[model samples]
Target: MRAMYTCSSLYMCGTRDSIRVAMSKLCTFLRHFGVVACIIQFCILLPFLCRTLPFSTYYGVTSGRINFQQRAKMLNEDRVKHANLYFKNMMASESYRHYHSIGNGTHMYLAVAVVTVRRSGVKRVNESMGYVLQTAAGIDSFARSRNFINRTFVFICNVDSQPHKHEEARFLEPYLPFTKRYGSSSFSVKDIQLPHSDLTYDEKMHKNTREKETFDYSYCLKVAESFHPEYVLMVEDDAVPHTDLSSVLEYSLDNHLVDKSKGTPVKKKFAFLKLYYPEKWQGFAFELPRVLELISIGCVGGGVSLLFGLMVRSSKTKLTHWTMCQYFVIGVIIFMLTAELVCRQNILELRRLSKYLYQFRQAPGCCTPAMLYPRAIVEPLTTYLTSLPSPQHTDLAIYDFVIQTQTPAYQLEPNLFHHIGMHSSLGTGDKDAEHFVSTFKIK
Candidate 1:
């Protein structure tokens, strides 16, 4: 019986020793063979970790709720501060002291026409400061900084038929060229006289306002044509220009829009070059070319990582079959591809830092805060816009024209201006402003 008990103890000890030895070998093998897999895993998981981690807890918060509210509050404060500053500047005579006027028969390289209407009934103090003032200040400041005041023409095209209703444009009249509708007639607000009693006054006004917007846009274009500018830039009164606005416009015109193959220059084959688009839509669009690009990047990264792993492993081991290594490589590729798709927004954020690194892609259908039309197309565009039978949003109308004509149109990435207006002059509040502070890429 004693010998049997001693044998049982020996067998248990041997089993424990065998398990420890096996675990040690497994650890050593993983340390060498699994290095690439570990790295791939880390790379794929990094974005998720950064997003999900409770880093805000270190700032005395359990979650990000307070942080988000604080950020929004700060942004509102900054916007109000800037708006007040711009309003003061617009009122000051010194701000436009050096500005050059677009006199009659003047030929300009670029003519900027800002379309504006009065915005009333806004509850916020910043909204009362007026978006037109801020936009004018931004453009005037940028033009003066770049010495573009001489070659460029900037003016306000006030669409408000009643001159008394739009005091902001009146304030700007002394500093900038101000255009208004010819007649003294105002849009009637009384809907009782209409045959359709079901439509509310607001609804009736909205329909009229839409048509007026289209007419106003056409009028501005015609006014722009009078200056004989080589390029016409149509800007919304609320769209604030970037600090590098002149530089980007110059670069875009010289590099992409103009054809200088012949001795005389000509416009490039494009309907219009859009300078701004909604930022929310500028994410990882599931397009064929973009998908192909991601796939190519994944393939190259996997191949490089695999080659590196094999080179290191070959130096240590003389294994003939690399079936496990090949499987690891496949997993790495899959992980990398998933990471590329998941973290695409981070990639775009990184690219936005470099102002010059912008791509021109086929224009997407959306708001048109800023657009550049070649001198040659201005008249034809004006004609087309005027001929439209029904009232349509200017953006949708232009998009329809582009589709019907099948003309090439392009939009710049990392938009050159910020859509800062919280209350739109078209009687609609910017609903998205609650979610996003500004659409400017750099900001």
Candidate 2:
């Protein structure tokens, strides 16, 4: 009888010990989780709190509580009249100055290879070319010299999917006058032709878009490589550089230094710099108070659960199955609260909060509106492009190449380039491109 009693006691002791260890782990997890959520809430609140408000009558009227959409609405009325004045007087003057300063240059320190495609015939202005011209002009203006732009050159490559009609090409020729290196000097189109596809319209568009973009990129690479520039800045025809871009570009490059201790100067010196994205890097939509409340609840519950476990502890007892289930329920509640607070963040926001721009472990975002490549890798980059899997979007192809080669790349905060192109060039016209029509009401 004593032997049987001893065996029963040992079994009870083992079960009690296991239950205690599980409770301890659960308590630690909840405490850590609550703390992490609090940190995330603070980071989300920082950007809006840090930026200063403009001392305007509009801000005063709204008490500075207005959102970006509301502020834009108020500013539009005030600035509408000056829009034309600024474009005609300020923009025209800047363009003239930029043109005179760099009137036909043979060599360049920085070469911006622009890939252009055909636009609707009715549209008079070439959107991408205009902004690029302005950026070069801004660089010149920043230095307070007209001829400073001679160090930079813009080469426009028109992809050759269809036969080049001189009459069709002339539609955008007006934008070319900003550079004296117009008319085949700076502007070029592919001479070869691509045969029509027997695939359905949607299918053909899906397949053809990548091929066209890849071809356009290769053309730009050839033109840029010929110049032997110290750095190649690749911009799709849809992208535009902000006027204050050069300073940031230079700062970002010099600020980030990835050691290539294993290779010579030609192997790699600097990482590829990303300059633009389609959206601001905001993570989640939870209100600051909402996150704070969730965190507080989690912390309080965790403490209560821990204390309850301690109080219920006895010499020879395991937690009841019902009690264990309650503990699990509490753990789940804590997880849901923390996950909702954290899951809204994008990779961009995470990087910014982490303060790690030069450090990259995954292949970066696959958008190539504006990117700078060091001269050291230009030859190897050319080889990579040529050997890449049969034509995909240049951005994705390049990203795949980066992963394959294990190359380090960099992305800057407050993207230096802006995607002003409203029209989607490669779409089937059913997607976001159709909304690019002007005069659409903004509610």
Candidate 3:
């Protein structure tokens, strides 16, 4: 009886110890789970806390607000980073050869150019010859004077898919050397196929124009992707250049004179530069400035403009190049026509407020001169006139004076971005061509 009672008591003691151990473990697990729950809740509330509460409200966290002046400094840093990233990617891809000027702090690289030839025959042949000679001369001058080192110009011939025409062959003969030297051998002269549309005549015309613009935009994007340029300047075959191409670019980039008295940092869209033509081309559409402001937002102009370039680069969805280009353009137009209208009047109001607002002097906007005007508009009034029916041909001499006088005059206006227009050229041969080649020299 005594032995049995001792064994039972020992067994009871062991069972109590086991229960204690299990209960202790359960408490430890609950504590761990509570910690995890708290962490999850904190993470969920993080965004709200950071945004609504001032940095001073946070006990342990660092302050978020830097001074207003420091904002510009931060932006400049960001821009430098953006430019560097673009340049490195271009180099790593071997998309284009770098021909940069250390002195000017501008990198100019040329990719193997591929031009599309539309026609065939003797006229086509002569055009090709002129194009090749002009292109070679321009590039050579760029290399010699502008510090261009590595540049290749490619020509893509879009010939008819039919049997080789003698005229086409002759046209391509002069450019053959260029083809062998600086260009890619991707030669196929095919018809530019149009997408099918069932619409009325006006609708068809509008649609066709849009489609063609989209195609050209796509082609430019393709070239950019294939070449991987830090920044690619697209020039038509007919575009020519004048003397000192690099100087023009330097001049363009050097325009940093901003009107501190006008426009707040948030309101300004146009960068400070001298416009070659100040006259209202359409004789002052009250909405001209507003329209321009909207256009500056980019993707709205059927996607061939500077904004289109930005959209393709910024897409988050691992979009294919072709699809991205197409969708981006569409999005721009759709968004502009719809949502942009809501804020149009407000932009104008902000412009008026800039003149009186003292705080605006320190707060600068998000555009550089290059970002404002990708291409120069030399004579808006004259272009407008010529665009009319049966305009008389005038001497090219008058153009220089008009451009120079008008550009500086516009600089004096409240329209701060006026100066960002065309910088008048000294002399003119083929102004468009000259603007294309000379306006964007590396140095």
Q: Which candidate tops lDDT? A: 1
Candidate numbers sorted by TM-score from highest down: 1, 2, 3
Model 1 steric clash pairs: none
Q: Which is the winner by TM-score between candidate 1 and candidate 2?
A: 1
The TM-score leader among the candidates is 1
For model 1, the stretches where C-alpha displacement exceeds 4 angstroms are: 1-77, 86-105, 120-129, 147-149, 182-207, 260-266, 296-346, 353-356, 438-443
- Write candidate 1's Cα lDDT for 62-141 as tens digits: 23454454454466456656755755645445434433444433567777888888775445423454568767767766
RMSD of each: 9.9, 14.1, 25.5
TM-score of 2: 0.50
Stretches of candidate 3 off by over 4 Å are 1-114, 120-129, 151-217, 254-443
Q: lDDT tens digits, residues 1-443, model 2? A: 99999999999999888888876876565446445544554345433442332222222343445454434334333332333233334454455445434334555567776655554323433422233333332223333333235576554455534414323223333333211111244333333222232432112332455765665575566566566666788877655455446555554444444334556423335447777654423223476743564565566656565555556555444666676556545644654454443332222333433333423222256688888887777666655665555776678777766777778776655455545344345643222321111121111
Task: Looking at model 1, report the run of 10 residues with the lowest lDDT sum.
Answer: 185-194
Per-residue accuracy of model 3 over 1-443 as CA lDDT, tens digit each:
89999999999999988877875675465435434433543444443443322211231143334342344334323433443343333332232222222212333343323232323343223332233223333433443454344442333322222213324323433333212111233332222222342431112222232233323322332333233333233333322233333444333233333334655422223212321222222122347564665666544544542244344332332435664455456545644543232233223323334333211121112211211122222223223322323322222222333444443311211222111111111112111211111112111
TM-score of each: 0.71, 0.50, 0.27
Error of 3 at 346 (Å): 39
Number of the candidate with higher lDDT, 2 or 3:
2
